[model samples]
Target: MSVPENQQEAKNKKKRKFEMPDTYVILFIVLLIAVAATYIVPAGTFERELVDEVERVVPNTYAQTDSNPTGFMDIFLALQEGMVQSGGLIFLVLFAGGAFEVVERSGAIKGGILRAVNKTKGKEFLLIALVSILFALGGAVGAVANSIIPFVAIGVIIARALKLDAIVAVAITFGATFAGFNVGFLNPYTVGIAQSIADVPLFSGMGLRVIAFVVIVGVTILYTWSYAKKVLADPSRSLIGVLDEGKEGESPLDAPFTGRHKLILSFVGLCLAFFVYATIEFQWTIDHMAAFFIIIGIGAGIIAGMDYNKLTLTFLEGCKNLVYGALIIGVARAILIVMENALILDTFVQALSVPLEGLTPVFAALGMFVANGALNFLVPSGSGQAMIVMPILTPLSDMIGVTRQVAVQAYQFGDGFTNSIFPTSGPLMASLAVAGVPWIKWAKWMLPLLLMWTVIAVIMLTIGVLINWGPI
Candidate 1:
């Protein structure tokens, strides 16, 4: 059965076509690599001392420990362990999904976005800027990454109304959030944690950080707006082309912006405000957040006139939609689990910090920034990374003539900016999942912005070193 020439050529082309790996596959590959590294990378540890009931790594005390290579059975065990460890965050994502679904069903989000779209028809830039700043401020104030998931739908509706794409939707919301988070002027998670460990005044280095925030956020807004205009002019240019084919008729514009919609949205706004206040004031954890989201769903459902059964079913359906995204958080955590079980995690930190000792102060500061960014891949938690690395880097900073403030700033820039692009970042994966944007698609679009931010970070750190930025 000899194939025709054209058909044979077509078959060859099909065989050669590249297909991006699924998110789970990519994560599993990372896990496999981590498991392999357990044997290859030497196991090591640092002495820790308790300060204010927190464990921090002791500097200049790196000890090579016995290798604890992960076995094949441990590979499967790590998955369960990772899920158990990340149970709180996973539940938070599911609750948020269910809550946002109830709100969407009530027409509140759609109605409000439509009204805003109509009002800003001629001035789209104002809408973009306003949304970016609000989310950026939320990020600046220590909002967790998963907190942005619930609001992505609102951004999507506003973006669609203005003929923009999903990338723009993510840009104005998630992108802006990370921009402020990376600058971290008042970010309690990264800045607060790092400063506390470094013995610098909490939230002390604000002047330069404020400038970085404005510049980074401004650049994000302009970059997003420019891409949006292009997508508007030519639909073919969209990164996620043919936006939401099945959802094209799902726009609730025909539904009038009723009193119930207003009431529902107002309650949502109040809930968000109170959520922020409680998070900062009461130091609420993800469990409290999960419970609060359930309240939001039930309240919104009742207000929307849904009976108990309908509400329950709607909530479950919403949870179902997010199952793929939610589980990914746990799977991504497995990578860290593998590293921890293998005891190679601290070795990475020690290796990264050693090179900085030999560089000039300015370059050393920049190297710290670069090192933190790399460490973020394995240890994604900002506060956790601070607890591990700050103890070592703080004293190293002093020895090398870099200010503690500058070291914390480097940690902030390193830890925050890479979250958007890293496949291991569960919140970023979840955000893209909710928006129906693939990881590869978002990465391709987000890399340029990250590069720009990197350059900005370099300039900022250089200036910090030059000025001896400190309150020491």
Candidate 2:
């Protein structure tokens, strides 16, 4: 029997009203689970020693410890503690947003993008490839994930001009940066730190890494291009549909490219060059980057002829816009705090590594990749994860007949690729927040590419094991 028209319409409306949880809700649920794991997962510790001023865990030193489950009140306290711990990073996101907003308000970014779009009118693929390669090179050099956040704005503007969605913008910027970071040809954070921990000469296995960089980056370009093509063929196919609707001919792209815009953009370029130099030469951290961004914002404001009041307000407005994304970084860090407080993080590392002991050399290498990928959720920072996991894995690689270099490679694969998908990843969440793309939409679109990259990683690792790629 068919329902009445009114009743049927109501039922259909209810069925179509499914809602995905907000980013904060998803993170809070994960936090609750982490707190629960403290009770279920046994607490353990590994012997750690200071190695070149960096603390590293020692293998075969796992010992069961009394559980320290987080109390109800501590759960709430973790949020404040997380913010305190990650203050530098959180502020960096805010500063970057404010800086970029200052520049965008000056019309430099939009003007430059308009010029590029016109020049590459029919050859948008060329533009995509070039931008992808440059960002990938940035990632390859330093594992600069969070540092790439400011550039997401430029990427979005470009995507909009090309009639693409925010996902494509993120894919070309964050996704491509992560691809090179995962391969890590000369990445000081992941590859350099892991190699140092494993006693492999820094960058000793460059040949294979360089090859992996090319293949992975090639795959990224093709995947992003394919998606862009689909979007062009049918706008509805876009993962994040119609970023700017009802604002036709009202975009920044329609504004005139004035001489002042060129001057402002030139200042931005100089600031970036100095930032890279300082980072490599002086080991600048997020705090330094944050300060640098503040300078950039003020400097750009002065160059744009904005009065003091307008500039300060613009900077504050920019910060206001990114508060949601900036806060996500702190909340995400709280997940780690819960595990650390419970003392289950070491237990998790021990559990993950134990099963790889009995596997064959190639399989052990593959297992390391998978294990590190899983561990990334617990420890998302590349250098931080290296300090924690490499000491254990480095020694295990010898017993399992896997080279230390290959072990390092596995760590790079595990830590780098998964950062793009993990909610625990501050940079990934911040980039999405900057671009206005929802996490669920990004995950649904990126999962396929991630799976393909996983296959490529497995193949590369297998080859590394077979040829015994190493300098150990």
Candidate 3:
């Protein structure tokens, strides 16, 4: 006969298993409503008309040279510029994604990751730090999703083989990497877009961004380790076991690391050498050198025996991965058009300063952060958001007594934070969908990290105030 207490425990287990996280479908509904409202409201009408005007203000490449351009021609100019921006963004995504695919496919990435990880797997503290730096590097390249996702899966597979619960696999590998994305160094989209919008330099927040990256990564490592420990201590609570109960340690899967892999990896190394040499030796932008990496990556992948057909296939797949982001980029442009239409983009800057003119620098930073956050929801596209918001923020910085650089950092915090947990972004959703981790689950994992991060960020901003570190 089953004991009464034991029977109660079973009942509880059944109930708990049936209980699900309540995802706010309302939030999703609200987003749809907002997008719809954009077409109905007078605010939107002004924006639309404003966009029409800007369309006239900007010139087509050919039409721009004519000093006596008509209003119709001006609209043509705006449209032409918009098309160029749209195409450049697509090309940038292609290059970024293609380069990552080529480099990782060349075999150096897995080998490097495996070798480095294997050395520290058993060492908890060391393992945590390594994963943080690993993803942070991935973030810098805008390949956190494409590359980090698989790398983490490999960790999960390896962990299962070793009888470790898979939470370590998901939480440590993907989670840590996502955290890095939250505070990446000069990302093409996140910081790059925000900086561009605010008219701040492309990498204006380098010093603070690095500091934020490290601070957040350190916090995530600690949390991931704790969560992993819980899974290890009580296997029932561990999701990793459910993910791959029968798998074994890296047992030579079908994917073989080849000499071609080594050769490709070597090219990556050479590219790095050139980057270092160029940056220190010639002062090239560390941020723009990503193209060189992509070029080397393609050459190496081909040399390493990635079939020409397969290489192209993989390259296209890379593009496919970012296809949604690319589309979102276009949709985001529509919103930018709306903003430029209203002529309110700069008005936001005047609004921000008028209220907080006398507040401490820390408060001013906080105010900008909030504005950037609100801006993110409407202009979810990174580059689009920047182009919409920055022109105004950049010119008004002097009046607000806040430096353009500080405004840029605020935009970064806003841009980076929302991307981690926002529903509007396809990349985050895509990654979660691929991993079978739901959006609610991501928010659950991320909230604590983001909460702790915000506190740390404010502290840093305050310190900047004390030291007068910002550009103003």
**Candidate number achieving the greatest TM-score relative to the actual structure:** 3
- Give the clashing pairs for model 1: none
Could you arrange the candidates by lDDT from highest to lowest? Answer: 2, 1, 3
* Model 3 quality (TM-score): 0.71
For candidate 2, give the lDDT.
0.79
Off by over 4 Å in 2: 1-17, 122-254, 358-472
What stretches of model 1 exceed 4 Å from their correct place?
1-16, 124-215, 223-255, 359-452, 455-472
- How large is the C-alpha RMSD of every model relative to the true structure? 7.0, 7.4, 9.8
Candidate 3, overall lDDT?
Answer: 0.58
Local accuracy of candidate 1 as per-residue lDDT tens digits, 2-28: 999999999899899575566577678
| Poorly placed runs, candidate 3 (over 4 Å) | 1-80, 86-89, 146-148, 162-166, 197-201, 236-244, 247-294, 302-317, 337-344, 374-381, 423-425, 429-442, 465-472
lDDT of each: 0.78, 0.79, 0.58
> Which has the higher TM-score value, candidate number 2 or candidate number 3?
3
Error of 3 at 258 (Å): 5.6
Using TM-score as the yardstick, the better of models 1 and 2 is: 1
